[model samples]
Target: MEARERVVKMGALKHHSIVRRILTLVVSMVILIALVNSAVINTMIYRQLLTEYKSKGIAISQSIADSASDILLFRDPATIQSLLDQHLTINGVAYLVLEDAENNIVAHTFVPQVPQALRTIYAGKRTTTATTAFHRLPGLGNVYEISQPILFGEIGIIHVGMSLKPIHHSMLKVVAILIPILLVVLITALFVFRSRLRFVTRPLVELADYTKHLAGHNFEQSLPEQGAIRAIAAEHNDEVGRLSETIVSLEDAIMTYIGDLKRTTAAKQKIESELMIARQIQLGMLPKSTDNTAFETVKIASYLEPAREVGGDFFDFINVGEDVYIVAGDVSGKGVSAAIFMATTMMLIKAKAQEHIPPQELMVSVNNQLIALNENMLFVTVFCGKINRYTGIFSYVNAGHPAPFIKRKNEALEIPLTGGMALGVDYHHYYQQRELQLENNDTICLYTDGISEAMDVAQNQYTEARLAQCIGQSKAVSAHELMDDILQDVRIFSDGADQSDDITVLLASWCHASASVSSELGVHFTNDLSEIAKLHQVVDIYSQANGLTKTLQHNLKLVLEELIANTISYGYRDHEIHDIKVFFTVVNNALNMRIEDDGIPFNPLEDAPEVDHSLSLEDMPVGGLGIHIVKNFVDTIHYERQDHLNVVEFTKSLGETA
Candidate 1:
């Protein structure tokens, strides 16, 4: 209902816009003017005609009075009456009467003149000439009554009355001719004015329409081209033309701005995506905290938090024989530059630590290499050391970094770290070797300045004393728990202050070596793929017995089908009996699977060609998806040619890697 009302109102507005209302106003004004003019002219003409008729009556009465002087003096009314009768023959002249000055009827036409017995027999006025007045006599129409002095009121007044019919008829004739011509002129004027109005308003209306179209994004109708818009500009050099040109200019400017905005938005989104990917890759490079883990010969945990998406803090661990190496480092500055330096430094440290090199000696080699490759002259502070898990011999190098704290399980006293020259500061600087024999329950907490120098909302640094106190209070907590408690305390102390630098903590202790753990499940099945049921039963029993999650069981089932199916489907050249062996082990906090089949030598890892994920389903190749799924679920894959057996083994860490 409202829509209908709106449509009606809009239609009215549309009709009214194009000179329709203006034309109505013009026509109304013209008709009013014509009627007023006609009325005024007719009134003036009627008055003038009445005046002339009165004057004629006066003259005729005077003439009759002059000639009737002799008759009236002798009192003979016959001659006087004959003179009055002659005047009555004229058209529109109803009657003429000659009466005595005493108002006695003397002569009259069409009726007998009243005698002195009448009501107004002698209504008199003293005048030298004729005087006239109007009268509406019953059945005689409108008439004029005039009287004049005959022989200076001596002979008797000669009264002459004339009807107004002739004047009214003449006035009617004039109006009859004027009205039709006025109507025709008015109609023609309306048409001409409306046509002229359209020319002036058409461009403006179209400009409004086009502007609305652009704003509404209603592109069903094609927009006018530049040439067409320019035509409007050239057609009239008025405001409408200027407006049209302005609309065209605005359209171009708006479109250009929108396009630039889209491009800028897309580029920003792309940069954000790359930064997200860089953050994942960076975090993945650092080892996860693992003090809760019961393996690795010690309880070592690490937490590296960046102020930004990427930061320059790093931590590492390596197990060689009965010794565990722990390292924590910070690159100079922060953000991207520091992150790059941190990555390079981590690679170099891991490479050297794997060789079982001494900490001080390893720092010497790492520092020189950094100086040679450090075109930006960046420096790094590192605290790297090795701890004998059994003998509790802690040996380390402190390179321009904060001291590593040694807190005993039962003592509150804090051991401060020693300082030396920072790496990349000199090409041949030898790092200091410091050894502190730790007791069985002593803990070593290595850190970057980001922790000791961390600021709260009040701009107060956490300070080395605070870290020592926190560790002392939390001394009985596990290594991972202690790290978490320190972080939580710092977070609460900061009171939501943003982490302004890279905060890294590498915690380790040569307390007790975790008891070794291992799980093995092997099932033997024939060549038939349906015999896979026996393999599934073997894995399910082992998984339930070891408290493995249901999810792992399902994943292992799919793994069995993919790995064993490949062997059964393609390993054999004939329909003959073949053996497939599948086994699983839980060792060193990791789940390891080894599949050995007496099939052709096929390394699934290297043989599985890379898949193009960008391809559509119809265009994507189908066979290697199962292998890809297995890799996604598993952390590591190893393929070895053990004699005639194709041994495919993979391991997934149950906790952080050492």
Candidate 2:
């Protein structure tokens, strides 16, 4: 109510101010017009009155001159005086005079005597037309003094005085009449105009108040119909009504927009939550970094940062028999869909690489799988390679991916590409494999375009030349340090600019290291019961040398005994001797083991029987107990058939549980 009152007061103030200004302007104009009209009327009346008085004075003087001409010829003063008196009775004729031929006044009608001022007239001077002159006589006031000739100046002239008092009196009377009429008209117009103005301005004032009310209130709610707003809208059929209607419609639109915005905001929040979860899942799909000591011949490190909650770039590295397989890929777009595609591609690449697929073959296979599954026609660029630790030979394939830098003895050089299209574009696209022999301590840096194309505030890109320069300038001694140096340099170059794409970097450095009791342990023995003791002896020596926990050693002994005993019993159909190669390494508090045996094909990861916890111990399966116990003791396991050999690899974290 208080707000409404304020609005009303404001509207009233505005209305009154406008009305008062308009009234003041109009009244001033009316008064000025009236004064001008009165001036014009007075001028016209004065002109008409002066002309009439002069005409009347001229006639009276002429009549007296003619009458006195005969009267003076007989020398009759009585008749001449009578004629002068008779003409004096005419209005505006102040006085009349008659003179003899000898300039003697024959008859005159002044107050008591004719003033001397008029007596100076010379009758000797004649005029063909009657002439008049104005003068202020001593007794008579202002008058037009007319001198008339009598019979061509043979007789004396007649002097007639026409007073100007009638013109003054007539002007005064006109003013009196005009002033009253003007006042009456002005008063009437003012009253009518003020009344009509109130009628017109009242609605406008209400509209202003209602508009102010609308501005103060929330527009999300429907406008009330029982107020000044409604009154003005219903009562008027003009611009005011249309304006009110438009305002109401605007409020409705605002309400709808606010509702939709709320829904959209909630939906967006939900999608963001889902995307965050998906980001975690996508990150989980990438390979976890292992300790540098895990591989005796290569040190590996990787860095990945998505531009958004989820991104399209991915990297993976895994041990492939005697070689280290590494891959880096980038999808075409960013966000959730790209992340999904990236996860799919990474899984495919890892699975194919684990199967001992070559770099070029893996690209062809993963590309076909992606093409069959890609409904959005999205594609991914990949650079995959296999580094042979024993031979220092690096074989790689580039599928429309950026070239990697090879840092050899402090010199950074780009590895030339064996051209191939990005995956998922054409299923028939062929990819070529290129080989480069790696030297000891040589670092290979693989990265996505995000590193090279990073922009600064000036829109300058951190190009490939910059990457090579950064790599060349780096004083890092290991793959992890070099990777960090490259990433840091890129960030410094970007200088707080927005990241436009996902960034990924993978580095691998090759070096020679002997297999010793400190870092690694390996042995080769026949699948004979006597040689199982040799495996135990080697594991015991390596554990004691490396300070491994007793529980880890026990778990390792139990798993190896179970797997090798099963292999000797069931893995071979022939009784001939079969050799098994066993290697162990302690990397970052975890024990990594690789087993290769030239026996019948067996994949312990999949061929292992399922252990049912629901069954009693006596009812439990018999053939799968060894594999089940091995799985329970180990953290991870991978099995593959490579070159007719069953290779089983597993890692056990050095935690209390084993």
Candidate 3:
């Protein structure tokens, strides 16, 4: 039964409207013909049987009427009985009866039995015209009667009745004939319908299965259109063929797109890699380190940070005998092209520096070189200077660059060297230079515009005023210390905004010979107090050998005391005993001392608290005044914290006036 249900469902899935219509027409025609034939057959058979019965009744009534007239005229009851017996002998006749006027029975016939009740009913009513009776006999079946008037001057009434057994038998025979014919028609229709449905539905079932596989992304299968199914395919040419063609086209397009994307990605990666290499080469062009102690009293500290892959800011320093040349410049643009032009400008400056020319002459030569190679119309703003370390004089040329600051003693001021267009403007342009004196403890700071033009997170520029203020506050620090402090301050102000350009600072200080003697002393000590006493003994030997003055002796003693106390106290804050070394030198009659310690770095000079002179001695802080007094007596001091050693140097002139 389950298999039969599945077959029926499969037939429904594949059934076509045309085949369904034909099956419906066949079934309807068969049912309509059966209904019409059954109705006509029943109607004709009933009418024929009723007519025959009426005719038989008429004939029997006429015969009985004649017999009744004879009986009444001749009074022969035997004749009537004979007539009734004759009629009863015929087939399907059950009984016969006759009644006269006044309800008196004339004659009666019974075949194998008639009920006494029927006889009584016949005797109860009488008429002069015809009368009829019907009865069911026990062995003779249904009966019919007919009667007629005697009409011998209306002497008596006559009636006749007969059976209808033949009509019932005929109806049963008709039903027996029609039932087998209907069964044969129904059986033939079932076989014929199954065969036709197979022809129509088999190809459709195959097509449905193929479509299911295709929906699951399996495009490799194809359908065979043949026979009756091919006729359907020929009608509309099959939508499945169009779908397969579209899939092929889409696959081709996807492959082409993927190939193009891969090629484009490779090309982009190659370009990016080349740009990185170019950036590295640009960085490699800058100077690494300067010649050590190359100039008498000059130091330069520079910093460069590019905002992008490359930059255009540069600085160069050259020493020519008694004079040192310094150049700090910024090109007009940024990136690789600007970096190329900056390199060219540095080469020109180097050539000019070696020629022993004045700053104005050097700028004129460098400008000619730049303008000759200025096909791209590139330009650079530069501040170039040539300083005489021996005379403490500087001659500089400014070409649209920010003015350099000069810290002379306690006063910090900007140099007034102004005039000349930037390089690459005109080939034969004249450059001007201004000369100024650098006093003792004076600092000449040369820088690029990147310093003063650096911006903070708020987009505010680190203006020249702020730069000057930072420089003034750090005047007591050495050249390197001052530069470090300024960079730290700028970084704090900028708050992680990129250093937009190069930062280059060069500081030069002049120390006279007479002021150098009061500063030079050296000592060495151990963890033992005897070793410290021995260090004092060695210092006395050197002071006596050099014939030092009382004031010089007092200053040297104080400097040594501070140096030893710092090494013994905070330098070994973990209480680890260590050795210390000190060296003294006199260059051109100026005293210089160098002290070294194998302890943690602690620079008393830098960390010293500022003294509030307004407060009285009783109210004054006692801890920081030691380094302050040491600084007041010395002309110049420098400290370096190198691996496991703190090196501090002190310098002063020997003359009483210093």
Candidate 4:
């Protein structure tokens, strides 16, 4: 009985194999015929519909042009509307419009307004004959538009649009009917022939099940091969047989790959851990928060954010005697390589800064050192400056960096770029030095391109112009507050965009110590004699608040009035108005005053005449009396011509206010 059952099974498989091939051939031919028939039918119907619609549109437009000529001459919109309505009722007529030669619509058969796309038909050059083209209206779908010029477009024009939506509907209907027929034939063929072929497919199913089982494990050893899968792999040499053999081999390959992956993952994790430690170490290399006690009158604030685990922007401050060296630099590129280059540049800067050399000389030294060590050809843009904390003189050098901003009073001005190249590019490149005079409460802002070139989602940058405006608005605030506000503004402009580069900002403010609660006062006025009274009022108020004696107040008022009167009277060569600025600071029972004016250069110490005791007041020259009084009232005075302005500074030691 068992032998008989085996014979029957083999015979059934043989019969079904023949049936499968015949059914497959019949199904392939049916699908190919259906596809070819649908494509050919759709193309023929679309072309026929387009040609018919275009012809109908052109015929209607020409008829309207013939009938509307009288209406165009009479300028009768009602008759033109009647003519358009008559033609719009025709089949597939989407819209009809009548317009004079000026392209102004006189009549349109539309529920609302005609589509603006139709206007271009006549809006172009005048069409002597009937012209036709295709267009897609907003609500009307595809359309065949035709235009006819009446009396060579001098009198008027007629437009007609025929809808092409019917062609699309016909094509869809053909596909819908043919697809179901193809599916029915395929289903019948599969059910009749494929159902009997399960005898041949059972072995394949067993191989698939064995493969899935093998995939679920780490494959500590080769899986026990199933009998059915072994039979297919060994007994037959067809596609199924080859697939079974490949799966058996794949089990061993997967086990080897898993071991390698585990080792690679562990190694990657160790590398990441090391990188994290390196990031912390790199951060520790940066200078700490400045101790206010160390930098007596100068307030410094800095902010740094890296685009990755490490970045390339750095800033440093080093004090040497009475001067402080400020450095801000950016190494090209980003990530670990840039961070290493940045670290190198920073170390070189510190080494050179210890020498207390001028900014330009220091830059030259650092540039040469970096070039020697630069194997990757990396470069850095640096801005280095030295500021005399007491004298308020800042000498700076730019090395292909963005110009820093100076916030004096309520204005933010960008220092002009000095012609220099970035470091490590060329050893012989010479750097130029520039100087600025910082007064009380003035701020210097240093930054990298990250802040200025920060981009929003739409790629708009936080430009330098906007940065200047922000600084100007945040004027008079402390360095810490200003830095916070600037960072906040940058955040708002970026609007959650991913940061692409490192960001660093440094703000240094000059806030000289003063005895009074109000540290300093700066006043601006034109060169007018009447401005003296305002000066007196200011001097009196300030001196009184600071507990100055009546004698000291009188002397202060007298000295300022004398110097200002001399300047307003003789400093100008023309009657045009000129501005004068005065700044006052009091510290330890002493008054410091600085006067600046853009007038003819005059140094009171050199230009003033000598007052000799032998010469009477009447014998003395007229110009020297006022200056001699000023010189006597102030204990120490200095004058210089800088930036085309006369700068006169004086300090008076008022002995304890009694």
Candidate 5:
């Protein structure tokens, strides 16, 4: 702890005072080196001064010795003394002395004698060779003296003293002048280096404080503005400046991230609340799993589970009129929006189914409603069917959803769910209804894509083939057991992976109670007279297959022709296309013919005139002949008005003769 405190304190102090020490060390060392170099230069200059003065002194002494050599050899001192006197007054020449080989002074340049500081220097070297030496002259600060043997003389010694007055004194004067100036310059440099310290340390100190705030998670702290620190950072292209800029950038990122986090958190809460409510509403819209709503001859089982809190998958079964409608579908999204679309779609299906609407027309109307209301471009794929409880005929329309699987005791496979795009694509789109006559113990399995697309941890799908195979194994089971087993298999296939979509499955089993079988063949025709030949062809085929005689076939053809001709003539008022449907069915060897027309409402069974046998042929009504003949060919005739259209049904027993 102590060590750490020291380090922290050092770091804090380093922000302010670190550069001062560096500059002090560098500037102090530079000033000290300058002073040392000046001293060294002064010494070299003094030495050079001494050497020049000594050389001049030696030359003067040699001139004196050369002049005295000839005179002293002849004992002529008078001329030597005159030469000495002439050179004595020259600068830095303290003395000039010449002696004979007998030790007798011949000439001297000094006025009296050697100075006290120069006496020992003059006597220091007595060799015959020349030599120079420095000595302290009493009045002069320093001097150099040289002694030489005059080579021009026979046997004479010369001694010269050169005072180092001007050169040495000038060098000393320079040292005295430079020491104070150098002290002033060093002080000024220290002040300048100290004042510039803020430029380098201010950013570092600001960054230190900023980092401390960040370390404490104090996100609310305001950073330095465009003040001194910022300006310094901008001006100075250094490590401290770059670090400060980076800190400012980090602060902006953190601020932005915090704002986004708050918004995201609030949005998440709102969505979760809405999803909770929507989930309840969506689940409530479906039929309860405990409520197995089915007729005695038909058993039903369904399951719906959402991947999200609310899902787009839904299934419903409603009893409308004499038929039961089962709807299984999926909308194109997830969560709240998808759940809303699913609920809307289901409600529409139920409303139309209650009116005994056929699946094709029901799909078209539902699609148009969705398209009109869908501002979000939402769509649904639905498989809705109407099951005739008494006859076990399943009529359904596939509106871009997955096709239902028809599993009997013998076969299991998927049929194509063709016709019509997904809802909300186009209001004018057409959907076709298909009919599947269910035998005993036949199961219709309707589902959404969730079943086949259920994935494993490895992302392998539980495909349609696998679903079919699983259902095939459970073909003999009850509807509830079959659905349970299939769901369990799906769970196994998932391998603990989370569901990615809404899984919905509806199983409806149908078994006809009666032993006799029924079959229907239908024919569609336009208003053209040429199409009547196709009606005739249907009549002959049904007649031969059901063991009807040729006469009965002819009579049936005539009855159909009269009904179709009446519909084509009077049913539609405008010049437009119309569909007239004729159904021929054999039930327990009884021929049942049902004709439907999308035309003006007219009950032919009630409006046909009773033939008047008492009148002559010319007095009878023309239209009564065809109706009268049709009334006699069949045992019973029935008529009903539905949807502004007409339905005519007739039945004939197999044992009846023509």
Candidate 6:
């Protein structure tokens, strides 16, 4: 039992010794790691400070050289010496020297009591020296000896020896500064490292806890993905940069996905609202059927096709007793603003029609209204007319509007009328009225510019000539049939092209007349004396048809003779050959005659010489009195120059005097 007890004691002692040795080894290893880390950090700080000191020293040296040269040039020795003394007082600038050409120091500023051996060694050097010598100096810790040779003209060399007192003082001051700084850095690093280690380890611990929690079906807390834990795992390189970029990309993708959903929902709502408004506005702009039955024998058919969600086309019909007013207009541009303008135009036309205003007067009012409200310079093209339904007389006005096609018994003719500028361009514009006598079963077709300007896939317009031909062929069809044929033909020509603007059409036919009086006469005359007899025939036709009084016939005969003689003499004066065309149409108890010439733009009203009527015929300056006689007897005369054709129309309203 005693030997067993001793063996146990020995075993316990050996175990204790082994534990103490392991503890000592661990402690020594910890001290070594700490010492190595401190040495590395200190070396980095020392190198940084040394680099700063070297740069400062070089800068100071260059500055001193520049200052000395400036003083020598200016011959200012006091300023040079003062600058040297100031440099010596600054920290880290151990010494400063300004020497003359002779081997004598001109200005030397140094700390007192430099070492003797170092001074002797510096003095012995023959050539200019640049070396840092270490020495012991009085009242200064370790010192550096820097020597340089200075030359000023042809004198002997001047040696400059300066003790590096400021440098030593700066080094001692650095040590003093470093003691507290190092202490703070050490304490801060210790706390920071502890915090960082915890920061790194805490996330790992949390991840482990999360795994444990997940095993228990609990996913309440999330792991922190950034900071120290991420730094350790990321390991700074391309991998870290890529991981950061990937996370940012994923975040952006999530944000974009959410935004897309919101935008889709809002867009759907907006489209629905727009469609509803378009349906309401479209239904409201159409003419009501209750007002159509007031006319005695007037037929009206219209079609409005909207290209998009809204249209800019509009048409209206208003009947007042025996008269009927019709309007077809298109506002420029499209969408909501155009729709608003269309509504305003419709209301203005309706209001003016209700006042029994003539088509030309109504157009002038509308133009003035548009110009007043037109801050954006928006204009509308309108073709407006008033039909004396009982008399079968069609009076119309065009405001830069496309001409309507008239399906006569024999031909489809565009109404030959002058149009003014578009509405909203100028308030002073005047639209002229034109009258046409429509017989029974004659159809008048009016349309918007969209029909003529419609383009095919290849961008070819459905031209006006093609439209005229189409109407001429379909004159026998019903109003509805005519509209359908024209619209279908336009669509076929367009060849599946996108509808760019609104398409609108209005067709009206006169089915009866109270007193069908036709005074249609044609005369062909040239600038020749032999064709003068046709003018008598023209006056005779008008006199017999209207049963004109004897005095009116004489006046008409005199005006016709004077106009014919003027054209035969002076119209073809410059050209060798020229044909004159005269057309006469009496509608609504008014006789209208148009005279066309290919001659130059000369207005008889303007160019006709004023006659001193008191002079004798031979003394009358021969050419002036003829046009003056025609102007005095005519009710109204107007001139227009279009292309190369000069047209003058004379209106003799039989209702005015006969």
lDDT of 3 at 377: 92
10 residues in a row with least lDDT, candidate 2: 512-521
Quantify all predictions' global Cα lDDT against the true fold: 0.76, 0.84, 0.69, 0.81, 0.77, 0.68
- How do the predictions measure up, each by TM-score? 0.64, 0.57, 0.43, 0.44, 0.49, 0.41
lDDT per residue as tens, model 3, 30-62? 778877886689678967886787677677767
Q: Residue-wise lDDT of candidate 4 within 1-658, one digit each (tens)?
A: 5754555566556555666676778678878887888889888988887888777787888778877887789978787888888888898888887778877888888778776666664575576777787888788888777888898888877878888877788779978987998789778867765764564465565675576567566666666664557678886677878887777667768878878888898899998888788788788888776423135457788888888888899998887656788889999998888999999999999888888899999999899999999999999999999887666788999999999998887788897788889999998789899888888887889999999999999999999999999998884477777888889999999999998778899888875544222637887768999789767766765676677778878988998998899899999999999999989897676789899999999897888876887977678666578888888888889999999999999988878662
Between candidates 2 and 3, name the one with more favorable TM-score.
2
Q: Lowest-lDDT window of 10 residues in candidate 3?
A: 218-227
Best by TM-score: 1
Rank ordering of all candidates by TM-score, starting from the highest = 1, 2, 5, 4, 3, 6
Query: How well is each residue in 1-658 modelled by candidate 5, as lDDT tens digits?
Result: 5754665676679865677677878687978887798889898887777667766777776666666566666766677776666777787676667766544555676556655544444343346677766666666556566767765334767767676667767797988887788878888887787768866776676666556656556455455452544675687798888877777778778878887887899999998988888788788888875544555456789999999899999998886544678889999989778888888888988888877888999999999999988999989999988787657888989999888898888567666565768888888898888887887778889989999999999999999899999888874567788888789999999988999999999988876633222246677778777668656755665565556777777878988999898888877888898889988887766778899998888888778888878988788766657778788888899999888668999987766642
Candidate 5: residue 510 lDDT (0-100)? 79
> Could you give candidate 2's per-residue lDDT for residues 1-658 as a string of tens digits?
8867877888899999989998999999999999899899999998898888878887788777777778888988888888888888888888887766677777799767777777775435556467888888766688887888888778778888888888888999999999999999999999999998887788778667666766776655765742566666777788877776676677678778888997899999999999899988888887667545335567889888999999999998877666789899999999988998999999999889888878989899999999999999999999999998666799999999999998887899898999999999998788999998988788899999999999998999999999999999899988888888999999899999999889999998887433225656677768787667655755665666566788877888889988888888788889898888888887777888999998899887678878888999889766778898999999998998999899999998876533
Q: Which stretches of candidate 6 lie over 4 Å from their true place?
A: 1-252, 264-272, 275-279, 288-296, 513-658
| Clash pairs, model 1 backbone | none
Q: What is the descending lDDT order?
A: 2, 4, 5, 1, 3, 6
lDDT of 1 by residue, 537-612 (tens): 5556556556667777777777777878877878777777988877778888888888888887888877886788
* Candidate that beats the other on lDDT, 1 or 6, i.e. the better one: 1
**For model 4, what is the alpha-carbon lDDT of residue 422?**
95
RMSD of each: 14.6, 13.4, 17.5, 37.0, 20.6, 32.1
Off by over 4 Å in 4: 1-250, 256-271, 290-294, 515-658
Best by lDDT, which number?
2
**Per-residue lDDT of model 6, residues 403-518, tens digit only:** 89988765788976556777778777978898989878777889887898889999999988888888888744566777778898898999899988888888887766322223
